[model samples]
Target: MELAIGIILGCCALGAGICMGIGAIGPGIGEGNAVSKACEAIGRQPESKGAVTSTMIMGCAISETTGIYSLVIAILLIFVAPNILVNVLLKAIGLM
Candidate 1:
């Protein structure tokens, strides 16, 4: 039972780590692509620089929300999962 609990906790931590690690990739790529395109647009039409920048910033900020959620989940999993698991374990063992 203890071993099972430990394994569950470990899995949660590992999953959280993976989630944060892989979850960042999409936003990173998207932000990079957005900036690159925005730069190109500005280069082509310097007069539209301000508008392009503002739009790019807005788009990037929206795109970043998923990464932020993943980060929050990762943090919760890292900090909260173990405690919840421990509590469940204790309850299962009739010690809580």
Candidate 2:
């Protein structure tokens, strides 16, 4: 628990939190916006609704991938790394 390591850990935690929160926000907004736009397009061009729906789906899938990665990283950071670090430190001190 040196000062520098503590600071680094805090920063990592903050970054991971921010990443996950923003990731969820961005994708949710993007998907909503995409759906809205697709609906508008369909309303304007009823004959091309199928094409609009397909493109919207593809774009949403691509946009959502980044959010998924962020979630996975955040989960690993928050749930996995701290425990592993604690175990390593405890073993090094022969207290575990």
Candidate 3:
């Protein structure tokens, strides 16, 4: 029972780490693309730099929420999953 619990928790931690890693990838790519395009636009139209930059910033901010959500999930998986798993295990084995 103890070994099973340990394995389960370890897997959960690994899953959380993986989730964080994958979650970060999309935001990173998106932010990079947005900034790059914004800069290119600014270069093409210096008179509209301010507007372009502000819009790009807004877009980046919106894109970042997804990464933040993933991070929250990862945190929950890391910290909360183990406790929940333990409770479930306890009940399953009639210990609860």
Candidate 4:
């Protein structure tokens, strides 16, 4: 039972890392592309730079939000879940 718990914790940590790693990739690329396009658009149309800059900032913010969400999930999985599980296990074992 203890071995199983250890294995589960390890898997959770690994999974969380993998999830965050995968999650960061697409959003990073997308945010980069958004800024690039926004700058290009502004350069092409100086009069509309304000609108383009605002839209770019909004899009980048949204894209970054996804990465933040993933980081939250990863932290929960790696740090929070295992601690909760250990507490639950102690309670079950009548050691808490």
Report the error of model 4 at residue 32, Å. Answer: 1.9
Two-way lDDT contest, 2 vs 3, winner: 3
Q: Candidate 2: lDDT of 7? A: 62
lDDT-wise, the better of 1 and 2 is 1
Model 4 weakest 10-residue run by lDDT: 85-94
Model 2 shows how many backbone clashes? 0
The per-residue C-alpha lDDT of model 3 at residue 45 equals 91
lDDT of 3 by residue, 1-96 (tens): 989899989998999989999999999999999999999999999999999999999999999998999999989988998999999999999999
**lDDT of all predictions, in order shown?**
0.93, 0.85, 0.94, 0.88
C-alpha lDDT (0 to 100) for residue 8 of candidate 3: 85
Could you tell me the TM-score of candidate 2?
0.69
Model 2 is weakest, by summed lDDT over 10 consecutive residues, at: 1-10
Expressed as tens digits, the lDDT of each residue in 5-29 for candidate 1 is 8798899989998999999999999
Q: Candidate 2 vs candidate 4: which has greater lDDT?
A: 4
Per-residue lDDT of 1-96 in model 2, one digit per residue for the tens?
576457657766987899899889889999999999999999999999889999999999988987999999998887787777766776787877
Show pairs that collide, candidate 1.
none
Q: Cα-based RMSD of the predictions, in order?
A: 1.6, 3.8, 1.2, 2.5
- List the candidate 1 regions with Cα displacement exceeding 4 Å: 1-5
